[model samples]
Target: MTHVAIIGGGPGGYEAALVAAQLGAQVTLVDSDGIGGSAVLTDCVPSKTLIATAEVMADLEVADELGITVHDAEGDVAKRTTVDLGKVNRRVLSLARAQSHDIAERLDRDGIRRVAGRGRLDGTRSVVATLDDGSEERIEADTVLVATGAAPRTLPTAQPDGERILTWEQVYDLEERPEHLIVVGSGVTGAEFAGAYNALGLEVTLVSSRDRVLPGEDPDAAEVLEEVFKRRGMTVLGKSRMASVTRDGDRVTVALEDGREVVGSHCLLALGSVPNTADMGLEEAGVTLGKGGFIEVDRVSRTSVQGVYAAGDCTGVFMLASVAAMQGRIAMWHALGDAVSPLDLSIVSSNVFTAPEIATVGCSQKAVDEGEIEVEQVMLPLATNARAKMQGVQEGFVKMFCRPGTGIVVGGVVVAPRASELIHALSIAVAEKLTVDDLALTFTVYPSMSGSVAEAARRLHHVR
Candidate 1:
């Protein structure tokens, strides 16, 4: 049987281990964090759990409009609810730990050896793990999969103190809710946290270097989210680049590049990520690294060195957990002599976890605008949908893009509550190369957010 050594233990690493084990390969997974890595132990699972709590708080804000009244012990109407940060954080951590344990159990059942250590490439086909007990173990493998993932990018002028100033991962340790939260960077991570805190009834200031939040997402979706944020009393500082962050006693002040300063009780830096590829002996093993120390891997997740594969954030792919897992699986399948398809990034679905979440698949408006791909498009407002109206959702829309003549659905975007769920249909359409007419003809439940997806496709079909 082939022997496979996987490093990192994130979605990419663990998923590959599972696949390799199932394919009759002896798999060894080396991890510094828990089996689930940062995605479960620190980042994705924790943040999404926090957002779920924030969603509840946001939903309560419109309870009265839905004819639901909440009252206190004295039978008096309660104007607002309070957020218990301590409880919320405990729950988040508990959920994260539970998920990590679950992943560990799964790995155990699959007979994949799990090592708690930091792994580095000893050579092209060897992994040296430095265990917590100060012992080192060397393992020989036919294939090595590196999925070390990424860390929060920090600036020299703005270092995270982990108290007054924080990274996305450190936010779960906050025992008290910040009175005024200042989030630097308008990327997906920053926007999600800013919106979550605002929904939880905190004064939030989002510092954006770009003209709007989510500069990388759909323009219309970003615009709608910005509007919703502003409407919910979030202070958005556009075109304001943060130069430095300094803490004074209990307050933290963010200095902008343009000579402006904003002070808050707490600050969060979400300025993207840096791959965790350094000191891993990758270059020594003949692995190629690109700018920002990201491992250079092809669609099949193969590194420059033969039998060396890299996946996840370390590879500088889409940075989504799903993409990372898919890459890892592809690597194992290809290395194990199984038929596999190279990754096609265009069909991948991604979502930003904010109020009125933004989800997208396949071609984007930016591509169309850049003349990268010509396509017919149609955007349908969710407000016109019967279910959206019933749910009192006034913001968001579904947009679809298809080839001009063939009408094949190329891309789509959904900005609505649970947009993540609604994007799956469009993702399938894009992945299968289903035409707009095909999507339009598909049955959809009435009075549903998914109906807007079909409606947009139906409209695109007619526009052709």
Candidate 2:
């Protein structure tokens, strides 16, 4: 059997290990962080879980409007809804650890040998893993996969002290809610945390270097989220670049380049992340390093060296867990001689778990505006949807793109509550190259949020 040695235990690493094992290859998984990687143990899972709790709190704020209210023993309607942050955080961490353990069990069942240590490429065909006990283990392999994930990016001017000033990972350790939260960055991570805290009834300030929040996402969706943030009494500082973040006692202060200052009880830095690829012997083993020290790999996850592959955040290709997993599987299939298709990012669906989550798949407006592709587009407001009206969701819309002539659906964007779930059908249509008529004719439950998707698709027919 072909021996495969994989490094890093994140989605990319663990997923690849499972694939190699199932392919009848002797797989050795070298992991340092737990089995599910940062995506499970720290990043994706934990943040989303926290957001889920925050969403419940947000919904409670509108409970009275829906004729739902808590009655006290004195027969008075109770207006207080408070979250025990300590309890919520404990639950988040518990769920993450449980998932990591489940992945470990699955790997063991697949008969993959796991080394709980830090691993690096010794060469194209071998790996040297340093165990936790200061012992080194060398493993020979027919193929090697590097899936070392990434760490939260920190700037010299803005350092996380893990207390009053914190990183996203450190927030869950807090036992009490902050009186005021100042989130720096205004990207997906920043917007998400800021929105969640605001929904939880805390004073939130979002610092954005750009004119609007979510500068990298769909502009329309960003506008909706920004408006909601403002409507909920959250302060959004636009065009303000963070100069320095300093903490003196319990107070955290952010100094902006424009000579402005913002103070809060706590600060969360969401400045993005850096790949954990340094001092890993990748370049020494002839692996090419790209901008920001990420491993340079192609669609098939092949590095510069033969028999060597890289996937996930270390590859700097999307830095999303789902994409990382797909890259890992593609790498294994190609390495093990299984019929393999290269990674197609266009059809890859993504979601930002802010209130009224933003989810999109396939083509984008930037592509259309730049004249890269010719396609007709349609957008429908969610407010017009019967379910959205009944649910009292006033913000968000469904937008779609399709070829004008062929009428084949190419892309879609959904900005609504659970847009993540609503985008799955659009993802399938884009992946299968289905026509707009396919979605328009697809049966959807009446008075549902998903009906907006069909309505959007049907409008695309008229646009063509």
Candidate 3:
């Protein structure tokens, strides 16, 4: 039987370990942290769990806007509601830890051995794991999968103290709610947390070096998010680059490059992530790294060295958990000599988890702007939808892009509550290369938010 060693117990490593084990390989999974990786134990799952509670708070706050009467503690009429932060944080952390434990259990049941320690490569086929008890073990493997993943990037000027200044991962340890949350980035993670905290009744200020929030996303989506954030009382400081962060007593302050200062109870740096590829013997094994220290891998997740492969965040792919999972599966199938297909990013749908979440797939407006793809487009506002009006959703839209002659959907965007789930239909359409007419012809339930998606597709039929 072939022996396989997978490093980092996140989605990529754990998923590949299971697949390799099922393929009759003896698998050993090594992780310095808990299973489920950063995505589960810290980032994606925990953040989204927190957002769920914030979403509920948003609904409660909007009751007054919907012309529904709300009562205050003294039994007087109230407009907006307050949030219990401690309760929300507890729920978020509880779910995250439970998920981590469950994944570890599943791996153990699969007969995969788990080594809790830092794992490094001695060679292409030899893995050296330093255990928590300070012992070391060398395991020989025919195939090695590297899924070491990434961590939140910190700068020398604004390093997190894990107290006042915080990374996204460190925010869960917060017991008391932030009086004012000064978020220092306008990327997806920053935007999501900013929106969530704003909805949860915190004084929120989102600092953006770009013109608006979600600068990396579709322009239309970004514009809508900015408008919504402003409407919700979030002070968006645009075109403002942060120079440094400092703390005074209990309050924190962010110094801007333009000589302005913003202060808050706490600050979160959602700058970006750096791949965990250093000192892992990647160079010794002849595995190459890209310009940014990302493991250089092909579509099949093969590294430069033979019998060595890498996947997930470490490979510097799209950096989504879904993409990571797909990459892991592809790696296993390719390495095991099974029927395998190369990674297809064309139809890989992605979403930014914010209030009125943004979801998109395929050809983007940026691609079109750069003269990379020729396409027709249509955009429709959700405010006009019957269901949206009833639900008091006044912000958001659905947009579609398609080839002019073929009418096949190349890409699309959905901006609304639960856009993450609504984007799946569009994802399917893009994946199947279905035309606008095909989507328009499909039946959508009336008085539903999804009907707006079909209407957007229908508008493409009348485009000039």
lDDT for each candidate structure: 0.93, 0.92, 0.90
**Poorest stretch of ten by lDDT in candidate 3:** 73-82
Highest lDDT scorer = 1
Q: Which stretches of candidate 3 lie over 4 Å from their true place?
A: 65-67, 71-80, 462-464
Model 2 Cα lDDT, one tens digit per residue, 142-186: 999999999999999999999998999899999998999999999
Compute the lDDT for candidate 1: 0.93
For residues 1-464, write the lDDT of model 1, one tens digit per residue. 89999999999999999999989999999999788888999899999999999998777756767888765666433244688998999999999999999999999999999898999999899999999999999999999999999999999999999999999989999999898999999999999999999988889999999999999999999999999999988999999999999999999999999999999999999999999999999999999999999999999999999999999999998899999999999999999999999999989999999988999999999999999999999889887999988887879999999998899999999999999999999999999999988988999998788998888877877554
Models ranked on lDDT: 1, 2, 3
Predicted structure 2: clash tally: 0
lDDT of 3 by residue, 358-436 (tens): 9999989999999999999988999799998888887899999999877889899999989989999999999998988
Cα RMSD, each candidate: 2.0, 2.1, 2.0
lDDT of 3 at 91: 90
Clash pairs (backbone) in predicted model 2: none
Q: Score every model by TM-score.
A: 0.97, 0.97, 0.96
- Evaluated at residue 153, the lDDT of candidate 2 is 93
Global fold similarity of model 2 (TM-score) = 0.97
